[model samples]
Target: MYEKYDVVIIGAGAAGMMSAIECGKRGRKTLLIDHAKKIGEKIRISGGGRCNFTNLNTSPIKYISKNPSFIISALNQYNQEDFIDLVKKYKIKYHEKKLGQLFCDNSAQEIIDMLLNECKLANVVLKIDTKVIEVSYKDKIFITRDNSKTYLSSSLIVATGGLSVPKIGASKFGYDLAKQFNLNVIDTVPALVPLTFNEKILNKCKLLAGVSANAIISLKKTLFEEGMLFTHRGLSGPSILQISSYWKEGESLNINLCPEKNIFNFLLDKRNTSPKQNINSIINSFLAKRLANIICEENQIAGNIGGLSNKNIKKLSDSINNWIVEPIGTEGYKTAEVTLGGVNTDELSSKTMMCKKHPGLFFIGEVVDITGHLGGYNFQWAWSSGFVAGQHA
Candidate 1:
């Protein structure tokens, strides 16, 4: 006989685990399954292993979705404070990093353990390393198959996340499952990933590798003021990664290398006070030594600041203030922190995260079209959406 459950949740990641706990808490027999041997691998490695679990400043505005207002209901229903309360209940020591990002004081495993313990207390059944072979719906019941067993449930929740960080088992299974159910799946792309430059640009900036500076990276109207890092492949840092979500192929990024000060004014002041100082030397005080030299050489400003003509000074200032770079592409899903698109939000109810046409089917987490900015925003989405679904699933 097939094992029966009130709800069957696929993927034991953040969303699935949270959903299972809630469902089980409601006195529903819940079964949470994953193909991986270990659960919460992404959470285990997130935030340099400390896990930026949630953002204090979480709002619907921070998310990107086809339906921009679709996330408002879930977010309002389960805000960051609600999750913070849960963390406090677990006695997980956490600290607030910059920009309202909250990270655990210890390893991310604390988060995984907390979720696992919640599931245990809620009496949620968990199955790891169990590959789902097939799924079918009949007589208002969903039937799912693993390699050696068949399971039946009244409700099915698909928390299988997006196709990012494939090494940790990210897959297109969520998108495929959405299609199988005739739900619209948006075209997916890598987000919160590094941008790669062309050979020409890379060659010019290659010497600046490992250099980091306070920068403002802008794509169209959106701007992110944070630290930008120069890498061998291209640029990767809080600012660049934040902007990458809004960037598209064939678009150029406007980078303000020194957002904290006006380069033109600084250089002009330096020209008066330190006439004999090399132009690059003045720039080096603000930027990295290697990047300063590269920018000076690229703009053909070789002499001291006092010897530079007005035109040369303007050119140098422009190079520093409004540097434009066109990236060839991104590092792709191999290293992307999240996938930008997924099951279309239009097909699911924002309040419950359940499919409009299919009563018992739900989609949550990164599998949904709503993608958050870098930091703890994505985790908040997972919690909000998962909680909403679990309440009704």
Candidate 2:
């Protein structure tokens, strides 16, 4: 026998749960299904377990998509403020971290509990450990089958997220499904990941590992001013992660190691006032001691400032300000926070998150082409897109 529902939502992530809750609240027989034993595994692991749920600064501009304006309607319909209000209604204690990111003060489980409670109140059915093997539409009904049973629904919502963390069960199921339905899917790549340097660059700065600094990292028009950390493999920090989204293979990153100070003026003053001091010692006062020594060695500006000429000083100052390094590639999807591209947004309705060519079909969250920057913007996209789909799906 086959179970019938008004709406069948694939995946039990944030978007799936929200859509199920909304559909159920409308008195629809909604079924939320997931292959994993535990729901919201990503949510449980996000934000270091505290879960950065939403960003107060969320806007369509924060997202990147082939159709840049596609996010405007959904975001405007259900914005960050609305999600914050929902958090408040659940009495989930949260704190605003820097950059307007809202995180739970207790545990991310608080968020999971809140969503589960909403689903319960709305009478949404949840089925975990259920792998959907097949889906077909006929006679205005969508049919899906698992190992043990078959199910049917009038509406089907695909919230099966992108392939970022495969350890957590991320897959290409959503993209494959879109292609199966004749929908266009953008070429996918890892985003918000760490950058790995080639052997040449890594060998030069291997000893500088564990050094972190407040710097400005840029690739073309995209620039991020945040903390940059040096790892044994390469660079992995907020600043690098942000720029990685904008970076391409063979592109060199222009990093300002000392963005707060004018290195030229600072070094010139040191050369005048403390001529007897070693150049490395003077640089130590400005940057990390180890990094300063490495920089001095790499530039070969040995001996005391008194012995160094104006030309060497200028070279060292320029090196500090405009440190250019070309990254070989990124850490890939293994440690990536999100996938860069997904289902082409041009095929879907912005206001409803429904497929324009097919009625009763919707795609939301990370599965869509829209990808937000680090912080809480991605979660806000999930809420906005899921909310919009639930209204019409």
Candidate 3:
């Protein structure tokens, strides 16, 4: 006998779980399914285990979308404060990390547990390790797959996420499903991943592994001030990850080696105070020894600060303030935290995440074109979008 559900959500991720909970609460017999052996594999590993659950300051501006206005409705409907209140109610302790990013004090499992517990309370059914072989719509019923068994639902939500972390079961299932219903999908790519360099630069910086410095990585008009790490292949860490979304191949990144202070004036003052200080020594005092050496070598600024003319000092300072590097490419989906593009927002209603072309079909989370900035913003999007759809589904 085929089981029937009021709502069937494919993908037991953050968004799917949230939707299941919401639909269940409304007494709409909901069943959440996942292909993975465990739920929240990505969430369990997010933020180094302490999941960056949500951002305290999340707005539509914090997101990147083809149709930017689409996110405004769902975000306003179920804001970050609502998620925070839920977390608080579960007695889950969390702390604000930085830039309004909040993480659990214990582990990301706390968040998964909280959501699972909420689903149980709401009488939601969760099934894991079930591969969805096919989806068909006949009349008004949705038929979905589970091994050889079939299930029916009045509403189907695809929260299959994106191709960001394939190790955790990321796939193009959502895109394929959207296409079956004639939904347009934006070209997808790795968003919050590390930028890689060509052989020349990689060889040059390979010896400086594990080196990190506060830098302003800018692409186009977007800029992020965060720690950038030097790896054997290229750059990683927060700044690189943040700027990766705005970057494309052949584009240059303007890096401020010292973003907080005016290096020219600082060097000038030091030159006046200590006339005998070497230029390399002065730079070394403010930067890592290897980095200072590299800068000096690259700029051809040799000898002591006392030996260099004021003109040369200005040039050196300007170079330091605006060091530019062109990235060869990104590490791609194998390492990306979130995907940049997915189901086009224009095909779905922002208010409820329901498809305008196909009623009762909703697309939420990273499967949609709305990709949040690198922070707790992505998870917040999952929650908000799911909440909105749960109300209508």
Clashes of 2: 0
Q: Rank the candidates by lDDT, best first.
A: 1, 2, 3
lDDT string for model 1 (215-314, tens) is: 9999889999999998778788999999989999899999999888888888888889999998877888888889888888888778788998878888
Quote each prediction's TM-score. 0.98, 0.97, 0.97
Name the candidate, 1 or 3, with the larger lDDT value: 1
- Misplaced by over 4 Å in model 1 are none
Q: Which pairs clash inside model 3? A: 279-305
User: How high is the CA lDDT of each candidate model?
Assistant: 0.91, 0.91, 0.90
Question: Which portions of model 3 miss their true places by more than 4 Å?
Answer: none
Clashes of 1: 0
lDDT of 2: 0.91
User: lDDT per residue, candidate 2, 178-295, as tens digits?
Assistant: 9999999999989999999988778755777889999999888889999999888888889999999889998999999999898888878887898899888889998999988888
TM-score of candidate 2 on Cα atoms, chains taken together: 0.97
> Runs in model 2 with CA error above 4 Å?
none
The alpha-carbon RMSD values of the candidates against the true structure, listed in the order shown, are 1.1, 1.2, 1.3
Error of 1 at 367 (Å): 0.4
